[model samples]
Target: MLRALRSVRSGLHATYLESYFISQCDKLSSKWLTRGLHSAPAEDVAEDAGVTAAVGARSGERPNKSNRNQEVRPFTSIPGPKPLPLLGNKLFFTTIGGYPMERYWESVQRIYEKYGPVVKVERFSGSLDMVIAFRPEDTRKMFQAEGIYPMRPGLGILTHYRSKRPQWFSSPGLVPGNGPEWRRLRSVIHPLLRREVINAYRPAQTEVANDLVRAIAASNQHNTKQDPSRHIISDTLSILFHYTLEAVGVVSLGMRLGCLASTSANCQAQSIIKANIEVLNVLGESMLQPPLYKLFPTRGYRRLSAAQDTICRQVDVEVARRREELALDPEGFTQRHPFLASLMNNPDLSSQDVFLLLIETLQGGIDATATTLGFCLYFLAGHPAVQDKLLKEVQHVQPEIHTLQGLPYLRAVVQETLRLRPSAAARSRVIQEDTIISGYCVPAGTFVVSPPNVACYDPQIFPGA
Candidate 1:
């Protein structure tokens, strides 16, 4: 039967194949659907062979042509590990307590190696069903199937946290949200993230970058060793984080955060940065671990809540400051910081919304940018030829704030680095409706993940792969 379907699939066009697959799936599962027999354990369903075979001894119903073809098959038929009863593959994640959770990427790679391009993993004892795809075609299917409002099933813990603080955030931000609220929030901030708006902040970004270089020079001078190689910034990631936070803060809040300052004068700014880092760490753990934090006020959850408060308080102060400045001298404020002023002018955005938006932008932008920069540095360090080529291009361009655009090779290096080690390694989407992928039926509300780390290595799509 599967062989005949494959033969027909080869001859049919793409659009026709979709309809044909759906029809086949319906025909295959019709008996179980008609008999209301879809609630059995997947293992039992697989072992039963057919409805008649499972119950025929008692009911004396003989296997007919229509009923025989419509027996519901186990989800395990779709190429994955043998799920353990109701727990499914959830135990796979919790095994050894922290080993699998800490090295999740490696674990995922192992699954991909064993199961090929497509695999299913259930979470929370079959409460959540996820289909992970490593092939480009499946990735495209997942994305193309997203209708007008694409739904991303983000961390629910964060959503619950936000819900508790109505005064701070009237609604959840883009990350832990979906549907109309997500759409409305996205549209409100869309203009601020546009090309022209980002380009307008080039001057500010250059200023922050220059300050960073100066700070690095100052720090290097303090090193007793004269050797260039030994004159390393003790914590390079911390320095980059400060640089990125300062840059993002300036662009988003229209204020210099003093993150690169050598002195401890900007205590509040430094505290906010620290809180942001803590928030990210705690949020990541909450996302991976079970929702035990929700039931019991765990230490990690308490820390997360405190960190969030610090971030929100700092952001609120900045927003209020900006609002007061706008009110005092609207014209001068608009001219000095047109982008932020425009956002402030929007009637649709409340002060809390603006504050959350700025916080989200700063939190997301800083760490991701810093991580990407680290990868680029690592790649350049390993590949001297590529580094030398990039150096020559930079020298030729003598890139100033505005002149950086002409260095094609430099841009290519960044692009290649992003392609090779994308900051966002995977993206998740909630299946909004029933869809078929690679001849497998995926029902609505299923969580689908596309791992670019795997797909980007496809030899068919990448010539040198």
Candidate 2:
């Protein structure tokens, strides 16, 4: 029965691949219908991938979903894992089998088992699609400098906004889409992400990290009897968010959020940032599945859209205020050290451009760094030996601001955490033209997903994947 099933599935895959290749050339019209799930469209197939795309996939069997003899371009020619009907290889991701995070990796590996290097999965609803890459080479293809493929827009809430003014709700730089305006913003703001600027931003980063340590220490001292490893004294993630936002604001506009000193956050910026976080949490899940998910709206979505407008308007106000300030004192303003001030001297940048760049940088850098800190803590709690080694390494350094440069083990821990808990689990690209990746002919605009989570755990690469 297994052999017969394989035979049937192979036939269907062949037809599917052939049909997709033809569709790419404008040779065939691949009419899509998402009724009762007869033919699972490519987008649906990608979403089913989820975290499995980000995490690595293990070996598994490919179930046959066809009764006819169809030939898919062999796996040797195409680069990704094999697909199963409607589900693609996503069914291999089993959420119930292991610890929450580990289970995600297990499920991903299962897809790799059946599919091979690159596998596609359908997220439940019309949320974005996913692609899991088993090989490092395949993964590297995604980071191409040319904007042929950029990041995915599946981060959810960033895409869904209810605002009257476009400027009011603009993301600036955080969300991903390709167009002339996006390109204009990217060109002017790209310099801020340069290596030197990231280095310049580190002083603020170290200050924040030290503040976090002190806060944690104070809490631990107060709860002397509690286990340091297990006690959740405070949310380090929240602290990091404020720190990053304030850091960006200081660097970009010479403004301060005053988050580090505040005992309780109550500012408008704080409220809006908090609300945005809530929206992200909601949109992230809501986007995972398709139209059926419409049956339920999570609290993240339930929050009145009007509040979102309030935040955008606040951003616009800041933009306008900065512009007026720049006009009134052009010479002194250009000399200012703030990020926005620095951009003022650049002929290519406008006030709107500066605002967008600053906002986007703040949005992208904050949650990602905070979440990363949390993941680092989680690992440190679980692996004391690693923590001890890191501490020892830190101690050997002079503890000066420059000391961070020579800390290898500290860097290793950070790298390991990033690998294990990437800020963005999956990176996506839209195929611009008909292309053959790993031998499969992918049509233009068909969302191509390559999850990085799997790369972190690959045993051949990471040794314990």
| TM-score of each prediction | 0.78, 0.65
Q: Could you tell me the lDDT of residue 298 within candidate 1?
A: 83
How many backbone clashes can be found in candidate 1? 0
RMSD of 2: 15.5
The segments of candidate 2 whose C-alpha lies over 4 angstroms from its true place after superposition are: 1-110, 113-116, 121-131, 142-163, 167-174, 199-207, 221-232, 263-270, 286-307, 317-336, 345-347, 395-405, 434-439
Cα lDDT for residue 257, candidate 1: 86
What is the lDDT of every predicted structure here? 0.62, 0.47
The top-ranked prediction according to lDDT is 1
Q: List the residue pairs that clash in candidate 1.
A: none
lDDT, model 1, position 75: 40
